[model samples]
Target: MSNSDFKGQIVVYSIVGCPFCMRAKQTLRDLELPFLDINLDSYGESVRKEVRERSGRSTVPQIFFNSKHVGGYDDLKALLADKVGLDRLIEEVKNNESPPEAPKVPDSSELKKEKIGDMDFTCELDEHAVLIRDLKMSGIIKDHRKGLTTHKNTFQANQFVDWLVKEKSFDDRATGIVSGQDLLDRGYAAAVKATRDGRFEDNDTLYRLLEHDQNSALNAGLTSECEARPASDLGEDLRKLILSLYNDFLTPDGKSVNYKGIAESSQFKMYTRMTAQLYRVDIKSATREEKIAFFINIYNALVIHGYVAVGAPTNLWQRYKFFNYVSYIIGGQLYSLNDIENGVLRANRKPIGSLSKPFSKSDLRLVVALDQPEPLIHFALVCGAKSCPPIKTYSGKDVMNELKLAAEAFLEGSDGCQVNADKKEVKCSQIFKWYREDFGKNDKDVAVFISNHMGPGEKKTSFLQVISQKDYKVSYMKYNWAINSQ
Candidate 1:
């Protein structure tokens, strides 16, 4: 598409938590136009103040359609409120036949060498921005155009492969193709996933990918059997008791657990006894999956009890006594917060102070490797902190569904997984960092695992689409260590 045909960029400058900003971007997507969403929160207050001065408004989302101020969400709605006018404009932009004076991109029918990172590979793109083939790279066509330099939306070509291979943590040898529809719907990430499962040859234009083609090789190896929740009463009673605790003391948001109420409850000790009883059942008797669910439940229950037993302290993590000394006997084995988490659940078999890896040898190592290390365990296990997954009652029957929902909720939750479409980067929760190995040894593995669990939504679909189409960066959001309370 030529610049004249393009309606110009939709620039959204807004704060991180601003709902209006989110709505504004969503509206732009609904119109099928690519946008650069500038989150001022990433740069802090000073930058936000600068934006306030430039936009002549104290609040956001300040939106610009073709570099002209269009007020905020309300103003954009007014302009696009006319369906015919907007459609005509988009059609004109898409049909523009004028090409650039000097073609920086190759012709649709010719092959050319593009230097990406350390390798010089033959790559080509069709007239509609669909990548024909890279010959060497796996996922290609991360971007079709860049925003104005004043907008600072352009990424370096050299950093593309480096970020994908080194930081995004993909195996360099991995191969895949972004389907046309996936490239359009999901953006770069979804394209990467599709590419991981896609194939490209000659005559595949970017527009062709956008067309409906069930026969497209892009769908290959993308299908999997849907997992059903397993039925088992292995931890049913404990779940009921945990539910009571959650209903009575835990607020809906799960940020706060009323330790005082828990301590004062006549049945608090009753629930604790129930935990002890559950763990008394021989661990070997339960299936490995049951063990995984039960272990997570028991771990969480003990953590809650630890606080109530000593009066829930607001400044919980500051006290070494809370985590170090607190212990519980589960399945005839003793465990503390650090012990059960790293040594048992993770199979790392080492104390907190000393670094440990999954399956590593240590004195605390359990002989049986039943519940092997799972990345989702990080989301399930509550470490008596504010940022931990919300307190939930998990039974063997619903453990599968429970964990899936927890992950989805955590990821889609506030500041959970922030995707910077402009920069082609994603900021994920710190849980991925602390237990990165559990997900995979590298970024690519983590991305693959996440792509599987991310729920069906416009935002997530768009995020993954971008991921699939090109090289992207991944970083961890800062951890919140405060006690998670209401």
Candidate 2:
């Protein structure tokens, strides 16, 4: 969506390098919003005195929304931690109104219990609740008394078995059974369940279970005969499903994901299954474009699945499991999102570094080059960022063509590389700069890459004409890390 949709007349009182003031404004700005700037410096002591008396604080950046005090940066961020908070602030400003009185913060004892299945539970000690559900569903407690209902045919049972080898260390607890009913009898699921349930809390292997490797891991619900089945089995269904999601829920012209609709759609559950199945495909033998296309689809599906499964990233970090924490068992190997992107998909061999971008979508970790990394994959992988390319269900047959199309679309679209032909320069997305190694070793190479991938029709003609002569300078635009959603 055009970011202007979030613009509002929220005011900021501040001076340069006053971190609280900067952060206060930035928090609003990060949501693709606009705010009124009341620079304390320009008005000097008069504005500073006004802010002190008005906000009851001497700080430079005493922020406001429609004249309602919003405290400083931390308070603003805390309010924004709840997704509805910003909307309230924006709405008040839009209507020329003041913020309504906030509901009283509930006491710890006032936490309401939620009914799940037949039990009353609160988020307090929620890990135990998840564990109880997992225990029965993973077939870890086949005796069927582990709180939640145990059914071999239930959804979580299938999901647990399907994703286990990919998510946890399986080789260490290998029981020789790879799939079928025998996999249910194996104790590996129990080990995983126990670990997550805190039975192994002090044991360091628990960490290793998630972060380390095992050699003789189970086939992750794949049997010798069924390994080849998933590639052909679910490919078409997933493609059609993903495309429908994009066509139905995503905005046509803006390509913004319909967040409310996605929160209600049933298609996301299929992504869990499809991702599991796709990971089993034999990418080693697939054409490079096919592999790239495969990962693109995989990444996009995984990202959408993440938002749907856990809700929107309200602040920055997810409250529940996300794509990077979730794993895929691919060809008997475990690959997290980090593993897939940097290690397997991209040519870069740097280890995937940090998960520290609590509110930012910019993650660039490195990995061992699993295959010949196709640079064009950058144009296709969507990381749920406003600055990133639109999600398209890519194809193996026309993956190369599809990659070009996506890149072209991005360049032509508002989110794509912006040009300042007046100064003999073009401003591109930070993706180009972040993964410059993928595009080229330096700026000159990057310029050539952009020129080559210019959009089609008049846009392409115009862009190329501008850059054809004097090696138009490439400046990376400030990337927008806001959620690319409605």
Candidate 3:
């Protein structure tokens, strides 16, 4: 298959700074395919509508090769795996080779253009003021005046103002000319500068500003806002914005934010407040299962976010707050933080003196008796620390995606199983050590569960065979009680 055939055949609809989008581009580059990247950030409502209608997915990093939707990052990876599929795509690209075209401009006839130096100023100033006020009240122009005030000194802002007046025909004097592009560019630049300078202190204020603007944009029907976007389409600036915002509002205490307070705060209500919004989304769910899953996922994500917030090592031990609390909860029903450390997780399971409590045995038995598939299974894993099995980031619609990623990430990072020329020995995760009964009818069940994913290699089979023979020695590793952070 010819690489040049793809020269004019690929159109990648992506947002900037999206990791998945970057991955897709890298894959295409590795395959020697030339393609056009349409930054969806610049896409107008009509263009976005066309994309959504065609793909039925609102997320970015949507790609069309030879007018066929290739799905998202996962799909692209799958296609590249098959040599025939890769070659076919390459052939199509070579046959359609042509010089790449410039970016397409969406049609917007309502945009009025005027020259600051030459055009007559007939549009009434009063009417424009009213329009601006209406936009602001409708939450479309969030702090428009503040944004415009900052633009007065910037060179790009001046150029944008000039463009609005001379090219877009907006009355420079009466409309107080400035382009939407100018606002976005300046907003992103400001967000980036803040991120690089480690401006965690200003995160709240910055997010409030963006939240205001997002409301304005939505009110104007300029964009649709959702929690989950394809990792490929977000631009660097936007991603930084999101990361900054996510880090800002996390409860330092590792406790859930007051639901009442969250509902009342405009800062928490806007979807642009990613962290606060995520909190609200989790707690607001009426379904108990959904709420439980949300809590588990957010708790795991927050543990990571907390480390980044403090500029600390993204390791489990560093996330002690969650681990200690969760471990306490798992050990028993403890009323307070002190009760857990001093009483439950710390207590000797075996009965002491006149106290008839057989602490260690019950703790062990409770853990053993608990079924693997119970909701508590998630909580138990979270408390597993570094040695525990990985907890997948729960996304409601894409359970499989999260599960597969979690499983693969865990296995790849683990040092458990290895196969020699004629023998196999795997140091399985402590999860198997602690919750052996949950795996199957017996210890052998855990071996089978892991082998399914380990593939049918001689090593995996040998390991399974050894477990079946009951000849393999079972040894427990020192389980890290440290929290899983980054």
TM-score of each: 0.48, 0.49, 0.34
Candidate lDDT scores, in order, read 0.51, 0.51, 0.39
Judged by lDDT against the true structure, how good is candidate 1? 0.51
lDDT of 1 by residue, 112-189 (tens): 131111121112222323232221143442333324312111222233444445644546513222232323332121
Best prediction by TM-score: 2
Q: What is the alpha-carbon RMSD of candidate 2 to the true structure?
A: 19.3
TM-score of predicted structure 3: 0.34
Instruction: State in Å the error of residue 341, model 1.
Output: 2.4
Which regions of candidate 1 deviate over 4 angstroms?
Answer: 1-234, 251-255, 276-279, 311-321, 349-353, 356-365
State how far residue 52 of model 2 sits from its true place (Å): 59
Regions more than 4 Å wrong, model 2: 1-227, 230-236, 250-267, 270-280, 314-323, 351-370, 456-458, 468-472
How many clashing pairs in candidate 3?
A: 26
Please report how far candidate 1 places residue 76 from its true position, in Å. 22
Q: Tens-digit lDDT track for model 2 on 46-86?
A: 44445656665533456777667877666787887777887
